[model samples]
Target chain A: MALLTVQDLTMHYRTKLGGVHAVDGVSFAMAEGEAIGLVGESGCGKTSVAMALLRLLPDNAQILGGEILFEGRDLVKLSEHEMRKVRWRSISMVFQAAMNSLNPVYRVGQQIIEAIQQHLSVSEREARSRVAEHYNLVGLDPKLMDRYPHEYSGGMKQRAVIAMALACSPKLIIADEPTTALDVIVQDRILRRINEVRAEFNMAMMYISHDIAVIAEVAERIGVMYAGWIVEMADTVSVFKHPAHPYTIALMSAFPSIKGDKRVLAQLPGEPPNLLAPPSGCRFHPRCPHATAECVDEAPRLEEIDKGHFVSCWHPQRRSQ
Target chain B: MLRFVGGRLVQIAITFFLFLTVVFFLFQAMPGDYTKQFIMNPRIPPAAREALKVRLGLTDSVWGQYVNYVRNVFTGNLGLSFEHYPREVWDVIKERLPRTAILFLVASVMAFVWGFPLGRYIAWKRGQTLDYTITVAGVLFYTIFTPLLALMLLFVFANQLGWFRTGGFLTPRLWLTPPSSPQSIFIWLAATLAGLGTWAVLARFATRRIGHPRPRRLAQRGLVVVGVGLAGLGWWASGLGPFAWDIVWHMFLPVLAVTLIAFGGDMLLMRDSMLEVIREDYITTAKAKGLPDKVVRDRHAARTALLPLVTSFTLSIGFVVSGGIVTETMFSWKGMGLTYLNALLIQDYPMAMGCLIFTGILVLVAHLVADLLYAVLDPRIVY
Candidate 1:
């Protein structure tokens, strides 16, 4: 069994206006020690899917039907108390906006130490030592642990958050938009650091990013999401080389340089549909150039297209007799 | 600025005129004039009462009486007090005003001296046991304990302790011998104010990190420690000594009663403000560096949280200056509350109205001071 398996995971947010199908029937799995990417636009349900696996959705959010299995155990049925024990030790999350995720009134060292102490039986000094060790591991000065958050720059704050996430040495670290706020150089440095840490610790990671190039730079496998559903999934190099879904094709066409081709970029037509009232049938049919009459009436099911590659479309290709 | 002041000056003029008209009608609406209470005596005839009413202008129109009252008020002539017969409203107010001002002035000074730092401490240390304990105690005080506590203080010091005068500001001896000059009166004021000033100076300098004479600095720090230690001693001081103790003894209950009310609110507000500031993103950056809670709270959170409190402090002064009628009555200190209440009870309407105007002006001046402080404290808050 894979380290984590998500099957038929559907989540919606019940807002005043209407039900927003944020995470609509998304499903994926991650093998142990393997990294994966969940890539989509700003309002896509990528974040919702991540939060649902952790069962940390807000009050208005509902997990209508889903099964999340971690280490062959169903995480969907775990009690809050049981989940708390597993959070830092088994599955930890480094939230977006590192500045807001970390509490400001405490020293960075204390915050990391708090996560460690909460998860393990350790003395204050032991926790401090561990925090100092992580500081070195993340390439931050251990002595700077006593400094407050305001003294650090934006990139440093993100690094501190990453260090705090890795302090407990969890099996999986779900980094949601970890480097989106950083400058290009800083983002590259952070990605390189994360890649280095993954190799050293041999830890599995789920990297979410809006940029496909950034995701390809760090993530081993990629899943292209469109309108709360995964449209393509394959090995990173193959997915970059031969895109299947129209949305993924548009993304690849728009940024051919990420595939080592410096061609003129052709941007996609129109914006993503508002999730509150998504179109019936295939949600992306409105924007799909290959849409026929069948695509308008019947939604597409994800199917294997080639070895270790999945594509979701009603009229996928000439070979799909 | 001149135009704004000009407008306010016009407002003050119109308000004063309208106030006189209202006071004139409201007082005449009483069952009868001061002489009517005497009419209930069996010997007084109907013709004699009517004669008294005509002489007193009881039959004049309300507007006519208002004009006469306004004329008298402007000419430094406050009408005679009904209760004291010939004593003008100014004389009665002058006699009582000092007692009220001194008590509240002392109370305000005491509250700020201790309360500011204490409130700031609790705010900076929010969600800790000390903060929680103070908050719980404050909620208990404002919601449940204050009135009962006020009564208990009145009883314990009044009935059981024969140490100090139960109520009133000065000894009968001092009241009988009026000071001949403003210098003597000012001296009395200085003597009354000596203790708090000395304590404040000691606190301010001792808390400073700057240069001082080495020995003086050490001595000052020692004094800070000892003075803080001597809270019980100072508290006990209120119950000992002859005439001096009587002032402290009587004043303590009222001051204590008012302090409990004001401090509880100030502490609660400060704590909430500090907590809100701590949640800001900048605070998180500060924390990531491993700074101590005190540095985070005092240097970061407190500096921001104190912006609103400058305004709150002025409003609190207004509340204190108004004087708690019950606290003053319990202390029997003859402050404004007691003076105002005594006048209202006797239907000495003009004297009562004058007291109201005096308090109204004081509260307005305090609010004006708050507006000035707002511009100084928060640059974003433009006048």
Candidate 2:
């Protein structure tokens, strides 16, 4: 069985403007120890998928329809108490903006200890020792754990946050743009450390980021999201070499590859369609360069286009190398 | 931290000096002096009136008086009161300080204790019926006229139900039959409070270092119980329980009126602050950690939310010590506000200036304490 499966997940945020369809029919499956990346532009529901899996959404967010199956159990049916037990112990998250993820007032070590003591029957000493171990694993000094978030540099804070995420030894870690707030050097170091940690533990990771380059470094498989829909999903090599959905194709072209011929990075025109009133059919129809009459009228289902590859487009591009 | 405090103290001293100078000139600019009454009385001849002005130091150059005022203030001599002849200005102010301090300080603390949790709860339940109801009610009480609220509470609780005294800080009958006067009782009260505050602080500091959770918790509870028992025994042994109860009984109506007027503002502030804090990314991180909602709200969200409330509470205590004018007048509470008003009404410059100076010192100290507390409460704030 897969380690986690999210099927037909639909989540909407009840705003004053209207019901914001943040995550519409989003589906994906991750095998044990597989690292999958959810890559999208800002406001494209990448973070929402991460939030939905853990049921850690805001007050206004309504999970209308979904089955978050983790470890062969349907998580959507679990009570909040049961879900809480599942969270951090089974599936923890490294939230975006590590700068603000740790509470400023608390000692960083105490916060990690709090999480440890909550789910496990550990003595304070034991938790502290575990926190120290995680700190070392994340390439931070064990002594720095006693310091407040403000006392640490931005890179150190992110490293501390990563340590916190790893403290519980969770089976799955949903890292939502974990390196978005750090400088390039720190981001690269943190990503390399995350990959190393994942390999050591053989833990599944769901990496969420708008930057494909960042995702490419860590995720084994890639899911390209747009307007609350996953436009394409494939193994990292397949998605990079033969991206089927036009949106994914455009996203691939938008980046500069050092190995490729010198070519101008293509800018995808227009903003993402507002989720509150997204286009009727394929949410990406308005922005798709190859949007057709059928694509304009009918929403496409995520279909198996190849062995273990999925694309949700009426006219899936079959680009030959 | 010591350097920060030292810098703050120096700043306060300068501000206080400027404040005293302003007070002196403002009082000096008044149309007439306390000797004006004697000047109109023909029975008191012009020579007697002139002697009175000279004795009161009223017959000096404005500059000379200013210099004399500054010098006297520095030496802790507030001079003699004009209206209450032969009484030192400091003595008069000292007599009223405890009354205002006890009543308003107790009321303000009660307001905060009651308001903070309510505000946190309402904010945590934002947009719900309970939140709306509390916000509406809190805003109503907060904006109500102080005198009107005081009078209404007095009329209902004091007059109609007879649950408490209608006005005054102490029962006149209780003091009449006493070897222990109100002054002695106030002194005892002050000492007892100071002792308890120190004990609590020390206990907290000592208990914080305990390693084992169970023993640490037991120690905390044991400390509290012992402290309470000691305070009770002390009160009973002193034979002042009845007098203290009488004072407390008399304090009820005014404290309630003031608390009702003030707690709502605190509640509203706490609610707003909590709202802002709950939106912070750390709160979401706490939730994502699988901690229960209550723990996330209080431990993570409310801790940061309490930052603004701390500054407001400390600063307000400085101003609140001045006592409420309308509340004091309506309740007939002989507090600092009333005393200051009476002195100004009679144009008693020394007494008024003394009151203003005391208030200025309190406000300056409160601001310094607020800054210091911010550094303590928020690790991000380095002194």
Candidate 3:
């Protein structure tokens, strides 16, 4: 059985303008020790889907419909009291922008210790030891925990945040653009450390990022999202080799390759559709090169086009071709 | 840290010197000198008036008087008061300082105690009816003139209800002399011990019940009940004489007025700060860590929000030295405000200069203390 499965998860944000369908009919499953990368543009609801899995959406957001099945129980049905027990224990998250993710007033160690003690009935001393251990696991000096977030470098802060997420030995970890704010060198190091920790713990992970290259480095399978819908999902190698969805193909072509023939970077023709009043048909129809009359009128559902590959498109790219 | 403090001290010294110079020069430029009161008296002949001006050094050159003033101030001689001749200006201030300190300390403590929780509650329930009601009330209290509030309190609690005395630090009827007899001394000592004992017992009880669930709250309420009962018993036992109770009773209106004004500002400040802090990413991080709502709000949000409040708290302490002038006047409270006003009215240059200089020093010291506290509160600040 999968460690976590989110089926038909529909989330909307209530704003003055209208309800924004941030994550519409989003479905995915993660088996034990599996790592799935969720790649999308800025407002494609990538972060929203991650937040929905943990039931951590803000006050303005409403889960219009969904089933977040974790450990054989529908998390959507769990009370806030029960859900809190699952958070940071069975499931933890590494938030984006480590600078603001950690409380400025508190020492880094105290924050990690707080997370440990909140879910576990452990003494302060025990929690401190656990925090030190997690710090070591994340390639950080145990003494760095004594320092405040501002005192540390950006890379160190992100490492500390990752250490905090690993403190409870959670079964599943959601990393939401964990290294987006760091320099290129620090980003590579942090991503490598994350991969190492994941391998060591054998924990399931859902890595969310806008950079396909970063996702390619860590995720075994990638789910491409576009305007609140996952346009495609397949094994990393297969998806890279034969991207079925036109949106995925355009996104792939956008990434400049070093070794390939010198070609101009392909740019998607239009901006992401407004989620408040998303298009009725395939959400990507306006920008899809293979858009047809049927695609303009009917929204396509995710269907297996090949073994272990799902493409939500009326006209999918063929592996034989 | 040492260098920071040293720098601040030098700045303070310069400020003090400038303050003294401005005050001295401003008073010198006034229409009349301190000897005007004597000159206006018809009983004093022209020859007597001239001698008085010479004696008071009013006939000296401005430059000579400035040198003398600076010299006297440096030597710890604040000069004699013009109104209360022969009495030192420092002596008059020393006599009144304790009353002002007590009034301000009581009001400030009460304001913080009442304001912080109310502010936190309002922030937690931001869009609720309770938040709106308290916010409106806070604005009303903050905007109302201090003298008006004082008079309203005086009328209702003192004049109309007769619950407290109208004015003065003590009741005129029962001005008991200090205990000279052994029996009276014994009674005073016993009352003092009783008050101390009651407080100790309450503290011990509270400390013991710190972690207990509902009983801790119950114990706190019980402690207040017991304390009030003991205080009432002590008042009756003292034959209802003019004791500490009389001072507290007379202090009621003035303290209430000051507290109302202070409470409003403090509450609104805290509320606004907490509202901003709650939106910070760290607060969301705390919640995502699966901590309870109370922990997230108090530990993560409120702790950070308290930075601005800490700054305001120190600034308010400086204002305490100035005292609530209008409120003091309305209630006829003999504090620094009244002393300063009296000095100004009589053109007592020495006394007025002393008050202004003291206030300036206080404000400068408060800022230095606030900077030091900022470093302590937020570890990121090195100096």
**TM-score winner among the candidates?**
2
TM-score of every model? Answer: 0.57, 0.94, 0.93
Candidate 3: residue A218 Cα off by (Å): 0.7
- For candidate 1, write residues A285-306 as lDDT tens digits: 9898988888888878888888
Interface C-alpha root-mean-square deviation of candidate 1? 8.9
Model 2: residues with Cα > 4 Å off, grouped in runs? B37-51, B193-240
Interface RMS deviation of candidate 3: 0.9
Q: What CAPRI class is candidate 1? A: incorrect
Candidate maximizing DockQ: 2
What's the lDDT for candidate 2? 0.89
Candidate 2 lDDT over residue span A1-321, tens digit each: 799989999999999999999999999999999999999999999998898888888889999997989999998789999999998999998888888989999999999999999999999999999999999999999999889888999989988988999989999999999998888988999999999999899899999999999999889999999999998999999998899999988888888888957888898998899888999899888888898899889999999999989999999999942
Native-referenced DockQ of model 1: 0.07
DockQ of 2: 0.83
Two-way DockQ contest, 1 vs 2, winner: 2
Candidate 1 segments exceeding 4 Å error: A256-263, A317-321, B1-319, B322-383
- Greater-lDDT candidate between 1 and 2: 2
Q: Is candidate 2 or candidate 3 better by TM-score?
A: 2
Candidate 2: clashing pairs of residues? none
